[model samples]
Target chain A: MAITLTRTRRKKIHAIFVYLFLIVSSAATVLPLLWMISTSLKSGDIIFQIPPKWIPNDFHWENYYRAVTDIPFFLYLKNTVLITFFRVFAEVFMSAFVAYGFARFHFPGKNIWFLILLSTIMLPGEVTMIPVFLMFSELGWINTFKPLIVPAFFGGQAVFVFLLRQYFLTIPRELEEAALMDGASRFQIFYKIFLPLSKPALITIGIFSFQGSWNDLLGPLMYLNDSNKFTLQLGLAMFNGMTKVEWGPLMAASILVLLPTLIIFFAMQKYFVEGISVTGIKG
Target chain B: MKKLKKYEGFLFISPWILGFFIFTVFPISFAFYIGFTDWNSFTEPKFIGFDNYIHLFKDDNFLNSLKVTVVYAIFAIPLGIISSLTIAVIVNMKVKGIYFFRTALYLPAVVSGVSIALLWRWILDPDYGLINLILSYIGISGPNWLGDPSWVLPSYVMMAIWGAGGGMLTYLAGLQEISRSLYESAEIDGANGWVKFRHITLPMLTPVIFYNLVMGIIGAFRKFNDAYIIGGAGNQGQFYMVYLYENAFTYYKMGYATAMAWVLFLIILLLTLLVFKTSPLWVFYSGEVEGTKNKPNR
Candidate 1:
């Protein structure tokens, strides 16, 4: 009885230690973000105050206003949204379309084609980045959204196809066969059945691709030269360059830049986590 | 009609097939040709075979960038995997408010790249930064993180550790997939928590660990945005991709950059192949013959 009592007490102690560690680590994870928000709200003088304030005495909310006004914030936002929309749309719908092909169809060299697709997922973009840049420059598409947006239409991303293909495979063939017997075309069945059934998977990739395009710095940095065409990420980089010392407004701008993805992630938190787990574990 | 039906799958996948040639195959082949020449995107291409590849071995910038990247990878990959796996283990405990902990821990990773770089720049500020301020409370001055040469890699490593929770969910999924029956069987055999973890949990989680290892390697090599934004003094933080970008755009050494890209690809491939070759030895897949157990069976 005494041994069992000590064992339960030891387990209790262990639980306490685990919770304590979790609390501390979670705070460490979130502290910088909270500090960013805190720094954003502080007036210029207090930002450098020793023993930084978690909550400032006076909330200078104009830092957000200044952050927007100092750069073309809304313009960058619009550009980012446009790029993200086109890319995500193409990636989501088109990847589903192509995945359906690989999922449901029998064709010559299907396994070979699937293997090629898988290899593309593993192939780094750096190898092709230069020549592709050259190709775009040759076509006079530099400083244009075409380079960022157009290639997404081709097959979305190979990873997206892989993800959607996996999802599509899990879908039963009975529905498709039933639709075929009822005289539905493959395209019709795909549009009407597979796409609807895979809403969670579609939304998952939608969020993933949206985050990819929206937060992409190198693509916009490489392709879009004109300020008007600058995405939010590039604009943030440019903002850092123009005003290296403006911490308050810079933090404010940083918050503004990350807000969309943050919101999307939290709103669709389930799909986000599911998408990551699926790719990480299953890949 | 029969013939058309036979090619229907091709019709569905034609976009990717076309894109594979245009965006992937053609450019890679073009990059191969370009890697041999001295073209600046403007002048007529002067064919200087293998010159850029030869020059890469001798270039100081290339060599430094390679060192920085490799050193950073060495520290970051192991530190990141351990931190994330530890967090996963901790969070896997059946406890209250675990959901909140998971979400809060993952929030930082959702913040985009440039913003993260910018945030860390301030957070790691030598004077009046949060880290330094916290250090000052204990009567120790924090090192200038992204400023000093020696601290640059450590600074990035710290950032990598902070964001380690980004992989926690995957590890959590792996942890959850572990059957309770294994623990029950181990408990019947009088195994303690640590022993059970060692004998069962860790082995079962090896596949997930293997996956993260490959990804962590790729991520370390391809690290760019943060390194670009938060450059260290004395070019200490000149990562491989940053140098590649500078070579291609800043110096207009397109051919040389492509050579660098090819080298990067090869290095990643070789490392990945090495890991894959060794995976069967360590990565425990459940359910196998007892006699063949722990043997490096293909």
Candidate 2:
């Protein structure tokens, strides 16, 4: 009995240690973000004070106002929304359209085409960077939204197609056959049946596309030359430049830049986690 | 009717087929063509015949960028795998309120990249920054993180591991797939925790590790936003993409940039192929015969 008691006590101690370790690391993960928020609320003088304050005595909420005035926040916000909308729309609708063809049909060289699609998912953007840039430049599409938005119309991204294809495969074929028996066209069946059935998967890719285009900096930096056309990410970067320091407004702008994705992630947290797990397992 | 139905499939997929040709195949081949030329977006791309590639052999910035990128991959990939795996294992436990812990760790992953860099830049400030403040509490001074060349790569490594939680969900999914019977059997044999983890857990997780490893290489080579944001002091943090970006856009050396981009691609492809060639020896799945598991052709 005493020996069993000692083993239980040891196991209890082990559990306690595990919790301690987890809590500490979790604190480390979140402290910087918390500090960013804290700094955003502080006035300019206190930002450099020793032993930083987690909660400032006075929350200078005007820093957010200053952040906007420092750069054209709403203009950039409009640009970001425009880019994200078209990209996500293409990513959801076009990827689903193409994925339906792959998943439902058994055509010649289907397996080979599917393999080609898979390989493209693994292909990084660097390979096509320069030539694509040159293509846009030659077409005089640089400094316009066309370079960022047009290519997305065809297939959006290969990974989303792959995901939707996998999800579509799980849908029973009998449903489609029934639709066909009822004299539904292929496009009608696709639009009404497959797309509606895969709501969760569609939402998953929509969120992915939304998040990707929203936070993308390099694309806008490379393609968009006009300041009015800058995305929120590129605008947020303007807070700190070559010869100045503006920590408060910078942190405030960082918060603004972070808010959209944060809201999207938390609101659609379920789909986000599911998409990640599904991609991980399938990959 | 059958012929019409058969042709419908072709019509449905034609958009993607067209996209593949235009955005993918044409550009890759065009990049190859440009890599051998002296194109600068002004005059015609004069065919230079490997001169651009040969010039890169003597380019210091190219060599330094390659070295920085390789050094980063070496530290970031393995350390990232381990840190994320550790977080995954702990979160996989049956502890109470573990959901909160998972959320906290993953919050950074969802946060915007430039925002994260901005936040970290402040946190790592040598004076009056949160990290240095903590260091000073223990009577130690923190080095200037992005400002010092020697410390910049390590600072990036620290950032890489912080975002390691991004892969935690993947590892968690991988862990959930491990059979409970294996652990039960190991326990019956009087195997200790470390022994069971080493023998059973690590091997089972190798496939996920392999996936993350391949992704790690690709991501490390393509790392840009942070480097661009922080502006790696003394060129210490000038990753391949940053240098490539500057060459292509800033300097208008489109041909040289394309050559650099192709080299990066080849490096990634060769490394990936090398990993695949060796994966059969390590990555295992269930119900496999001896030495013939992943080797299909053999």
Q: List runs of model 1 lying over 4 Å from the truth.
A: A273-283, B287-298
- Candidate 1: clashing pairs of residues: none
Model 1 chain B worst lDDT window (10 residues): B289-298
lDDT of 2 at B135: 80
Across residues B1-298, which tens digit of lDDT does each residue of candidate 1 receive? Answer: 9989988988889899999999999999999999999989999888999999999999998999999999999999999999999999998887999988978777756776799899999999998799998888899999988889999999999999999887786678788767777788889999998999899889888878888899989999999999999889878889999999999999899999999999999999999999999998999876552422232221
Shift in Å, residue B184, candidate 1: 1.0
Model 1 chain A weakest 10-residue run by lDDT: A274-283
**Best model per DockQ:** 1
lDDT of 2 by residue, B85-177 (tens): 998988899889988898888876688667878888888888868888878879988898888999999999998888877678767877887
**Model 1 lDDT, residue B273, Cα:** 100
Distance from true position, residue A257, model 1, in Å?
0.8
lDDT agreement with native, every candidate = 0.88, 0.85
TM-score of chain B of 1: 0.95
TM-score of chain A of 1: 0.96
Q: Which candidate should be chosen as best, given lDDT against the real structure?
A: 1
Please give the lDDT score at residue A226 for candidate 1: 92
